[model samples]
Target: MKLNKYTWIFVGLIAAVYLGILIWVRLTNPVYLQKNMYQTWENSYVMHPKSDQSFVNTSKNNDHQNPVALSESQGYGMLITVRAAQKGWANQKDFDRFVNYWLAHRDYVGDQRQTETYLMSWRQYYNRHHQWVNDINSATDGDVYIAMALALAAKQWPKDATYYRSLAKNLSDDILSYEYNPQTGALTVGDWVTRDSKYWQLMRTSDVMPDIFMTLAKLTGDSRWRTVNNTMLDRLVDLSRLHHTGLVPDFAWITRDAAKPVKPNAISTKYDGDYSANACRVPMMLATSNNPKARKVLKKMLRFFSHQQYITAGYSLSGKRLVKYQSASFSAPIFFAVSHHRGEGYDNLFDSQKYIFSKPLTHKNYYDATLTVMAALEGLN
Candidate 1:
């Protein structure tokens, strides 16, 4: 049917009004902005191969190859899903799918029925037999994040709180039992770390998550969690004293009296001692804590970054930039830290880097993409 000129004009006016309202809501409502960002991130990485399960696949490596999944990524996805669900951007089913994937791929032995530990197997892959398999060991950091997410899920959904809380309690206990060093009060790299292992004394600096530790302590009524939190906080202080810029290493040796950065090629790469990929997360992680020592650590980091023209991908302990490229993983954390702790005169610095989050997420870099959205969600509050 043909419409008259006046009717067409009315239709155009209604469409314009609708578009304007959407733009206004997007610009003025942080929740709407966050939900939009979360949806983009979700659609980019989260995959559902079947009706009941889903996973966040790892992005291509330097070789341009990909893994089926990483437990670390699983933990990241679960935490983000649950947090987004709290904001109504996600739902219980979305969170449950991530949890189901973790359940289906837990650390195990010869038979899938035999549970090796509550901790998740760190990686998943397609075996030569065309069957799916997971690495036998568990990364402590992944376990920590998964446990924290479960605890949070319990609080977020009352009807299923018992189930979530039960899982959280068991995982938390196993983490303390297998991954934590009671004597040193430090978290080991993974479940494979034994006392006799040379790396047993080593702790990934990024594994020092005090806020998560406090949550676990409350969930399980464990004083040791408090001790672990304090021990790592003290280690950060000691490590900070080693450098004027207060940069931390990717890995550190936790001795009886001190925490020291590892030597080059000591753990993973030549940048082990440098503030590289792993250590890049320290700022955002510390930003989550209210502890005075945590705040002190962040202050030192912000001071160093604030003086820099750009926050590059990597840095040296002596405050030298290692890479010219900027990364969301590095910048988002600094942005979150600067925005989180206001009135420190770093507002201008925060403004400078806030554009990083506003830019389109790099789908090839899942770590950066996930962390960027997580930081954005955190900063929204």
Candidate 2:
């Protein structure tokens, strides 16, 4: 059949439009492209099976095997809402539902006469009996992200700004009161007020998110957060120096000396000062900082990883590979590191992203997926 002139014109127009879109997306900043692709990939993992309001980790790591982590769910909600606002996608309803679920289930400690409301349980476990069991202690990193999300939501939605800001402040206050170590001028890994004294001695380097601290400082007019931020920066450098490889350990031991404000005696013996899962986030956190020192540390770490033929899941402080298997969680953060520095390791960022993008997110691996999202977002920023 002979096509009409109008039909031929329509076909040409459609093809041109499609090609234009493809070129536009490809020509856009790589980080922005990554964010768009990551958002598409993340849609499959963010869902609620039981409560429409709440999201579950649902990755192979947690689905049916363990209870939902309030921290993880809240973190996911915050990330979604913040990204939605940035993209002008308007996701307030879903964000509100998530906030309500956790607010209703907020954890409290102390006796009936003297109770304190801490953050929600860090870990929630679903048993064979089909009940959710809540772990008492809270992870400070989760709390920080939730509070930051609330603050961002307030900024994004002006109509609910007052309510969201108030909630964020309350959460921030709880974090400051319970998690901040005045002696060390750093945030603890968990809630110190509720946990035993022994637990306060150890600090997770990844938990020292400078961006969150700076944001809270600006929002709350509190200099303590800024102080913690500085302390963490200096401590990161010190820890790297201690290891002599610019790689931080998963956990470091904090000892209070009369002469000094806070001293990291050594990497925690129990946690072993290794460049493992928790430590991998050091670069991601540092990449958020505009400080030159942070950049130096990140560049050093990225260069160390660049020498390896293949990035592994874990490593020793002395640049020894601990795990043979490569993981998105490990590689994505390295991508962020290299992207930020544009130094000797800049080429590595693409290699890492290429490896990450090649793998399909079928396993629903919570850590891997979350880090992948974070790496993508950080690189864009």
Quantify how close model 1 is to the true structure by its C-alpha RMSD in Å.
6.0
Window of ten residues with lowest summed lDDT in model 1: 59-68
Instruction: Write one digit per residue (lDDT tens) for candidate 2, span 1-381.
Output: 357888999999999999777656643565555556556544654554446466546445545455365675576556655765576543777677667666755666555423545475677657679787766767788788888888888888889999988888888888888787887777887664434576565667887777888888888888888888877777777777665567888877664421111223343343356787778888877776777667777777876777778888887788888877888878878787677666454685555555565434544577777777666565655
The predictions' CA RMSDs to the true structure, in order, are 6.0, 7.2
Candidate 2 wrong stretches, greater than 4 Å:
1-43, 49-52, 58-67, 88-90, 111-118, 192-196, 256-271, 343-345, 378-381
Candidate 1 local lDDT, 190-302, one digit each (tens): 97788888998998888888899999999999898998899988998889889999999999998756988899999889999999999988998898698999989889989
Question: For residue 151, what is the lDDT in candidate 2?
Answer: 83
Q: Which candidate wins on TM-score?
A: 1
lDDT of 2: 0.69
